[model samples]
Target: MSNNDFEKVIITIKVRGSNEEYDFEVDSKVTVEELLFKFNEFLSIHKSSVKENQRYIVMVETKHDFIDPTLTIEEAGLWEGSILILTPV
Candidate 1:
């Protein structure tokens, strides 16, 4: 693959309220916003639907710092093996 080819990495996420581990495919160029969107989609389909007025939280590498949902995943500096915790309200 060329350097310009999009590289995909797998991120592991543990969603609140469930014991199942979620694995997500993310492109290297994806932004934080795209990550959240992908996460939300994963929740809605593989896990549960995002409730109204519920706040979704994303934490990287078990760090307390939270990434804004509006930002793209790529902007969040997500890499391979990045752990994202999804807390649903």
Candidate 2:
């Protein structure tokens, strides 16, 4: 595969019920767990209540679809400039 297949892409992550939107760079090889960890870190930094213990789900805004936490970015069909919504489970 070409390097572009592993290239990092910029995506927007918006937490539902909040005015916060975070721009994150992620490679297509990244897994959903890795993405969640990043979100958890962001929450911790912002002092948000949605930490690691809080059960939450990530969905693709374009498709209104829930992403499998075990899937890789590519497997999840996430491309550059994708917007994901974070909602409580």
Candidate 3:
């Protein structure tokens, strides 16, 4: 693991069908899939009603492109204030 592995960034989370947005401080080393799971759990904890969409397309929202689940946040080129979305697939 490199120094960037421990880099921390603040990112915004957007879930489809829900008007709410969440901000999370996370390590850049975490994989996209892991972030998705974390957000899913967070959604359940905050507002259980917002988990209507089981299948979602997670992406770096500002980029408007679907991100690979296996790639780490840094590897995906995401930076501070990036919006990660769990949009309907």
Q: What is the lDDT of residue 75 in candidate 3?
A: 91
Ranking by lDDT: 2, 3, 1
Model 2 stretches astray by more than 4 angstroms: 1-5, 48-52
* Residue 24, candidate 2: C-alpha displacement in angstroms: 0.7
Give one digit per residue, the lDDT tens place, for model 2 in 1-89: 78655778887888799898888898889997788788788778888655565657889999998889899888999899999898877
Give the least accurate 10-residue stretch of model 3, judged by summed lDDT: 47-56
Candidate 3 lDDT, tens digit per residue, 25-78? 889888877777777777778776654435678777777898888898889888
- For residues 2-64, write the lDDT of model 1, one tens digit per residue: 868888888888766778777888777777657666666656675455553345677875576
The C-alpha lDDT values of all candidates are 0.70, 0.83, 0.79
Which candidate number has the best lDDT? 2
Task: Give the 10-residue window scoring lowest on summed lDDT in candidate 1.
Answer: 46-55
Number of the candidate with higher TM-score, 1 or 2: 2
For model 2, name the residue pairs that clash.
none
Candidate 1, superposed: residue stretches over 4 Å from native: 1-4, 47-55
